[model samples]
Target: MIGLLSTTFGVSVASALLPLISVELFAIGLVLKEPEIPWWVLALVIATGQIGGKLLHYYAARGAIRLPRFLRREKSGKSSPGRWRAWLESFRENCRNRPVWAGSVLLISAVASLPPFAAVAVIAGWAKVPVSTFLITGFIGRFARFGVLAAAPAAMATWL
Candidate 1:
């Protein structure tokens, strides 16, 4: 059980940090292999791992940590801002105007991955959303998401 939990947490964190990895699929497989592990326990472990991994991006976006040169955005010396920069500026302004909506978007992305949770985490931090708010909403949303995902295999087995 300890080994399974550790593996779950490791995979969850790795998936969170790497866009190519899919924690959702991993959770499904884990459930199929270890039905004895409680679904909620799996959910909590995954949520903690994911949020912990994403916290690095949040901290970087919030300027608590500096990104290395490769990850940092290069300044465009052009007289006018580029299209992406302009759009980002506009989006930042909108987030500033409606704080609740910003938080809602973060929660929605965490659960549904509509806009991609990785980007949302950075955006949430860049927009100055409180760290406490980010962690609370992120964990709740991830917990809910993984809870359903981890239970899917058992649900399917019973139905079959």
Candidate 2:
């Protein structure tokens, strides 16, 4: 049981890191095949793994993880910042001023995947949302999402 849960956690982290992987599909399939594993246990494991994985992007965006030279933009030799930089700065500043709004958006994105949770995770970190807030909010949102998905197979079985 420990080994299975550990594998699920690792898979969840990988899914979080790799865009091509779908942890939702994985949780559903796991539950369908191994109904003996408690749904809440799966949800907790997946949620922790997901948040742990997303921390990479969060730290990278926050400038803690140094991006490679190729990923970094070259200076344009212009005195003024580019329009995109200006916009990002503005957005970041707005988020700093309205942390609750930013956190709410992050919560919404994590749960709904609207506006893309990956983008939001990077943005949230770049915007300087508190680390505690980020982790707590992300965990809650992801837990809710995976909890439903993990339980879905059993729910359908009961219904059908």
Candidate 3:
């Protein structure tokens, strides 16, 4: 129980902070080694924790946008800032004008595990996507993604 809790917590925190790491795959692999426990339960726990962590990233990005210094820094830049600002403006505009497309992108990114979820969460927050939409889609995607990751090893082990 303690190991499960610790692993879930560690994966959640790491997933939130680091986009490069495949926390779901790692958690699935770790849980797979401990066959005493049901793998599905661990996968669900990891998925829940990961969703919670991603929410933190989403809110953090939202809060950062509200900071005066962040705005000032964006405005103060000449070359880099200009390019970033333009990109941000375009992203925001797309989100506002074509919400379905923007939301679909987020959903796809979450499910496919492409473009890294942390980056998608940050972008979704910055784009001001609906909180409910983000949470629901993120949960669905992460759950399926983790489930697949957890099942793959088991399937392979049986085959081998």
Candidate 4:
């Protein structure tokens, strides 16, 4: 659990630094003038960072708040555990016992993948998703995203 939290913190920081990292990698000649990081490395980095963030989100949600706490920065502060719990309560009537929780977790993760609301990591944490599952899913999703980013320029360069 502690490891997951730390990993997530590292991942979040990495995501925040992605633009600068790209430039540095380019300048360092790790990424050539062709203007793309290698697909495998890009996928690995994205997966590591995103999964780490998601794990951190889960731990944060699971950690009950205490008074007079000092945090480095505020959380994403969008939909929190409180909000999610309330929503679950209201929807409990129509929800079955088994599928509801897991389904909601996956659904939230999938939804978070969309733009302007990248909350998969946070949502997965709030939903108490298994760390293994979160990491696996995150890896797959991040790989797909990075693969697209890496491929775009190469594909277009072929035409040019």
Candidate 5:
């Protein structure tokens, strides 16, 4: 149980920090092996850890914009804003313009493997989406995602 908890936490953190790694895949492998941990419990733990890690990414991205270099040169007069600043500004504006769409996309990214949850979390933070919304939607999506992954192996085993 301790090992399972540690592995879940570590995988969640890695998944959030590294976009290329798929937490679902890791969970699926564990679920297929049918460890001593209960599937539902494992899913809940994994989802919770993933949400925690994603929240860290979100806050980090949100804080990054506050840096002096990210500010408009006209306003700060300290450093010239570059393409990154412009792109972020445009992306934020786009998100602000279509909040519902942006939220939907973020939710989908959390549930599905496409588009990468790390990127979506960072974008959502940069877009200034409410943290509460991010947490709520992220938790629900990740729970469902992990649940599906955990169940798939069992279903496949039954089929075999």
Candidate 6:
């Protein structure tokens, strides 16, 4: 769980750093667009990073035993169940005894894929969502969001 929380934090921090990364990513391509990182590329990177982070976060939160001691802190005070229970409860409300856990997982996954809100994945994991379902839904949700981000600039570039 500690690893998952860290992964979530790291991913959030990464998302926050993306604009800076975008500058570099576009610079690497030697593109002269005013926006250093092309919107599509930025979106793709964000999507990919978040998806990977979420996967790691899920497994880490799932009590994967292979993680090293530094990675898995069984101690309390930080990233505790009580600390995050509210968020988990909020997420569960949406699930609300839904017949198909997959659907709930998809919705939660989509919510978590959004920047700044990706931490929701940790809460979902703590809720004991099935790994396979979580991964598939998360991937699709992240991809869909990236698709929107990728298409936005192309659609709006005419105005810019």
Best by lDDT: 1
CA deviation > 4 Å runs, candidate 2 = 78-87
Those runs of model 5 whose alpha carbons end farther than 4 Å from true positions after fitting are 20-22, 64-90
- The lDDT for every candidate, in the order shown, is 0.88, 0.87, 0.74, 0.49, 0.78, 0.53
lDDT, candidate 2, 1-25, per-residue tens: 8988898999989988897898888
Counting clashing residue pairs in each candidate, in order, gives 0, 0, 0, 2, 0, 0
TM-score, structure 3 vs. true: 0.78
What's the lDDT for residue 12 in model 3?
Answer: 68
> What is the Cα-based lDDT of residue 63 in candidate 1?
90
Candidate 3 weakest ten by summed lDDT = 70-79
The 10-residue segment of model 6 with minimum total lDDT is 23-32
C-alpha lDDT (0 to 100) for residue 105 of candidate 3: 78
What RMSD does model 3 have? Answer: 3.4
Candidate 3 global CA lDDT score: 0.74
* Local accuracy of candidate 6 as per-residue lDDT tens digits, 25-118: 3222332233444545544554556666566666666566267877666756755467456766766665556527635556554645343324
Relative to the true structure, candidate 6 reaches a TM of 0.52
Write the residue-wise lDDT of candidate 1 on 7-122 in tens digits: 98999899988989888888888888879999999999999999999998899988999888998889767898889879877778878898788778878998998898999898
For candidate 6, give the lDDT of residue 104: 54
Per-residue lDDT tens digits of candidate 4, residues 57-114? 5566546433245753566766657876687554443233444455444444433445
Ranking 1 against 5 by TM-score, winner: 1
**Which pairs in model 2 have colliding backbones?**
none
Ranking by TM-score: 1, 2, 3, 5, 4, 6
Give stretches of model 3 more than 4 Å off. 20-22, 64-81
